[model samples]
Target: MTDRILLTCGEPAGIGPELAPLALESGVDFVWIGDPRHLPEGTAYHEVVAPSDPVPEGRLPVLPHDFAAPATPGRPDPANAPDVIEVIARAVDLIMRGESRAMTTLPISKQALKEGAGFGFPGHTEYLADLAGGVPVAMMLASTTVTPPCRVVPATIHIPLSQVPDALTDRVLEQAIRITHAALIRDFGIAAPRIAVAGLNPHAGEGGTIGHEEIRRFRPLLDRLRAEGMQIAGPLPADTMFHPPARSRYDAAICAYHDQALIPIKTLDFAGGVNVTLGLPFIRTSPDHGTAFDIAGQGRADPASTIAALRMARDMAANRA
Candidate 1:
């Protein structure tokens, strides 16, 4: 059976409008959520139904979303932010209401969304979590790895390095571990996922020389996880965590800070990385990269990440089904 997915084009100014057609070929039933006006010329539009139908060749099925105002490619208007957010809300409703099985989100511009509209959260992960009634969530970046292959999650996300020390706590580390582990087994179909947790300080705090976060906070949580029979090993050196030889020991690397986790994965596969929100009521995946306003309408944006996200969403839905 084919899974029905709600595909949201995050921002009208981004490459989302261009990538819709490619996402349609990912071997799942997709109902696109965005303005029909934003769709490329010559694209056919279809209405949303109880049991959504598949798109035909030379046509794209779009579930129309309201845009507060008109959109110009590469020029983001805040007035349309509400409509952009509504697209997400509509997708969520479809899954919650059983109209769709999953959601694949295209990248949206946070600055444009906020300055143009009103949303309190930082990004998609936070917004999606709030939509699901405040279920705690973690963002994971998965991609093809060459030297050191691993799935990755940042313990503390969307925050500055100075705040990372204060945010590293026993509760945070343990929660991240539990969610990542369960997601691997239930969603990714990994029976026993080996998770590697990275330390906040250099050289695992250089044995408490560089920093005490590893000794005081993360280690205790890691110990507790071990006691729970989880296959976890970390408080490992952040610098060496992703090194080709050392990375094979684990399935996913949990980093202490944001950039520490993102840099390695983004460096490895910028265009193919998929940003997944684990522990959501419904499956939600997005391109790892963000809204590219620079080349919005020039037809120069690379849809690899969007294609990857669509493929991942299809696979995940099939796995769950």
Candidate 2:
């Protein structure tokens, strides 16, 4: 076990491999776990026997895992899908064993993994949750550069907008709120976290004119949590909850849907946003964006989010149990 963070190189065919060399600019102590061959040609790297090995300056420390095939820019090899899945599991094992202080994952293509390797999980969050004994978790996108950092958690994710009404049960919203609240205190070191809840419809149902979900279920849920001494505000209109004044009123915003939460933060800090999974046993953070197959091998891939993810992971790990 080492004090450094263990980074998993996700989707070799994507820009994940190339970003490692660029993320080094953040100067956070971390080692990458992936096939060295997948890295951009002419990259400086050294193979380490264990995760605890110290990395030399100007070189990436690779805990190598060979893939079934070579990676091509802008294209994923289904033949290497199982290998990609294995790398994530291996990284999980290292972290669970306390071999690293935290974990930072690059982006991955769920389609490729599912079609090639029969991946059953929805995405990294679900798979990681299953791996950690089916513990409940929430996805939070946290801005790294904003004046008052913007943090958001979408109660319902990866589901169609029409399906949101049926999917976002009182149980789901309550769990997301509990997880986000606990994580704000545990991982972020906030003594009294104020969570702002966003409504499911415009104008927060306009007092039941636009929609009833806000008045029917949302308000009741917030009332319960507030009675427990939680500083909760809203079932407010999602439209007006993200402006500077609204943002300053809460530590994190719990939105009704994915776009409601992500659109505001991604618009606020595109490059410096980091995706954090709340309620996980081990610390995990990732770049808010996905695999940029369009610029895989090109030198145009920016490392801002990756660096932010690393720094955020370090900060969270320092506050862990």
TM-score, structure 2 vs. true: 0.98
Q: Write the per-residue lDDT of candidate 2 for residues 1-321, one digit (tens) a residue.
A: 576888998999899998998988998888999999999989999999788887778999899999999999889999989998999999888989878868999999999999999999889999888888899999999999997889999999999899999999999999999999999999999989999998888898999999999889988889989999999998988888888888889999998899999999999999999999998899999999889998888888999999999999999988874
- Which candidate leads the pack in lDDT? 2
What TM-score would each prediction reach against the true structure?
Answer: 0.94, 0.98
lDDT of 1 at 168: 71
| Model 1 error, position 135 (Å) | 0.4
lDDT of predicted model 2: 0.91
Q: Can you give the lDDT of residue 181 in candidate 2?
A: 94
Which residue runs does candidate 1 get wrong by more than 4 Å?
Answer: 145-148
Q: Model 2: which ten-residue window has the lowest total lDDT?
A: 49-58
